[model samples]
Target: MRLSELANPSRFNALAERLLPWLVVATVLAFALGLYQALFVAPDDYQQGATVKIMFIHVPSAWLGMLGWALMAVAALGTLVWRHPLADVAMKTAAPIGAAFTLICLVTGSLWGRPTWGTYWVWDARLTSVLILFLMYLGVIALWRTVEDPSRAARAAAILTLVGAVNLPIIKFSVDWWNTLHQPASVLRLGGSTIYPTILTPLLITAIAFTLLFVTLHLMAMRNEILRRRVRTLRLMRAAAANP
Candidate 1:
């Protein structure tokens, strides 16, 4: 179907429902394979040993945290610039999910660090920037809740989302731009991946699984948002009729 067709809430809802079952199957299969590889097939790190297993989870969470925001940023543009009906829904639904993933990333990163860096927490540039991202997600959620009018809330949140997007680049490049306890990029970089193929393969598979999981969750949230708005509209209508 054409992209514009999804601007219609009903069409979007129908499409989401149709795709959800397939997506769920794909997500489950991907997770099964990824986890099996991560747990049984991949060898432990020479240095970090079994602790390196954390990377399978931590890396995916970190990636999805960033991806959720990036998706929000695009939806924000749709809300403010194009005034697409579903854009706000997309933007709003993404915030809480994104925040959850960001929290996971931070917690796992800290756990990984404790064994490696001999500390649970450090105010490294990369870590600080990701924290800021999580906070921004909270701010956007609060902003939406504070405004009663849907249009007004969408506009306000859109601007906030765009402004918060500045943090994305900062989070990505913080390790490169400053001296930090965090290690440099080992997966995606200028000189290809530094990680060995055996480990890299599972990590990549896990990343794909996490990505599919995110998409499935995001689509489900959007569907819920559409139903919620309809219910809200009906309630307002009934209340107005009773009062009038």
Candidate 2:
């Protein structure tokens, strides 16, 4: 089906219902296999030792933190430009999930950094930008709640999202932009990945699992939002009938 077609709430809900089950199954299975490989199969780093194992979770969380915002940006565009039916739902539902992932990324990075960098936290560019990203997620959620009308809230949040998106590139390139404690991009380099194949395999698997989990959660959240809107509409209608 076309993007325009899916913009209808009924069509969107129907598609979500059919896909949700398969998403859940895929998410669970991928996470299981990914965890197994990351814990047992992937080789430990020579320098970081066992502490490097945190990469399995940390890297993926960071990826999702950025990816969630990127997805929200697209949804925001849809709301402002196309006024897609599911756009606001996607944008609002993504905030908490993105915030959670950003929190995980920060905590795990701190844990991994302690042994590697001899510090738990720093004012490094990469770390600071990611912190800002987390704050932006909170800001978006706050905007959504503070505004009473859904349409106004969505438009305000959409504008904020677009403005905050400037940080995404800074977060990605901060290590290169400044001399920081954080390591530069090794796996996603221009030439090729520097990581060993053994370690890379598990990292890839775990990342996929995390991505699937994010999608599943987003879909579920959207579904709930739709139901909540229905309930609100019904209550408003009943109130109007009672008065008239």
Candidate 3:
């Protein structure tokens, strides 16, 4: 099928419904296995001891924070360029989830920082950029709500999302572009991972779990938004017919 045909809300909804159940089951299984391995199977770090266990959750949340925004940006591009019907729903649904993950990342980073950095917060490059990303998410959501016209709001939000995408690269490269308190990339660098298999495996699994969770939640929220719009349109049509 062509891209435009596939972008129909009903088609998207059908596909989402079919896939959601399987995704939910996989998310649960992956999370259970990941948590078990992270907490029980993974060996404690020689330096951080039990505190290193936080990495499984914290790192994944951080990864999703960036990933979610990237998804939103792509949706925004589709909305603007292709005029894809489902693109607005995709961007709208993704905002709150991205914001939540960003909050989790910040909170968990603070928890991890206290034991390692001797401080709960720092104005480091990576940390600061992530904070900005959280703010951008909030801004987009608020803008979406403030506008009365749905199409206008979606376009405005799309513009904001596209503009905010400039922050994604900054957030990704902050650890490398500047010397900071936060450690450099381990898994994503040119060289091999610095982490041992014991810790790396659970972290990878948790990252997958978190990604699946985000996708599942985004689809559910999009369905809700579509239903809301349908109801509004029906009400408007009824009012028009009654007046006529």
Point to the candidate with the largest TM-score: 1
Quick one: best lDDT, which candidate?
A: 1
Candidate 3 local lDDT, 139-215, one digit each (tens): 99999989977889999999999999999989889989998999988988787899999899999999999999998
In candidate 1, stretches whose alpha carbon ends up further than 4 angstroms from where it belongs are none
**What is the C-alpha local distance difference test score of each model?**
0.94, 0.93, 0.92
- Lowest lDDT block of 10, candidate 3: 1-10
Candidate order by lDDT, decreasing, is 1, 2, 3
Candidate 2 segments exceeding 4 Å error: none
**Which wins on lDDT, candidate 2 or candidate 3?**
2
Report the Cα lDDT for candidate 2.
0.93
| Candidate 1 per-residue lDDT over residues 127-179, each given as its tens digit | 99999999999999999999988889999999999999999999889999999
TM-score for each model: 0.98, 0.98, 0.96
Please give the TM-score that candidate 1 achieves against the real structure.
0.98
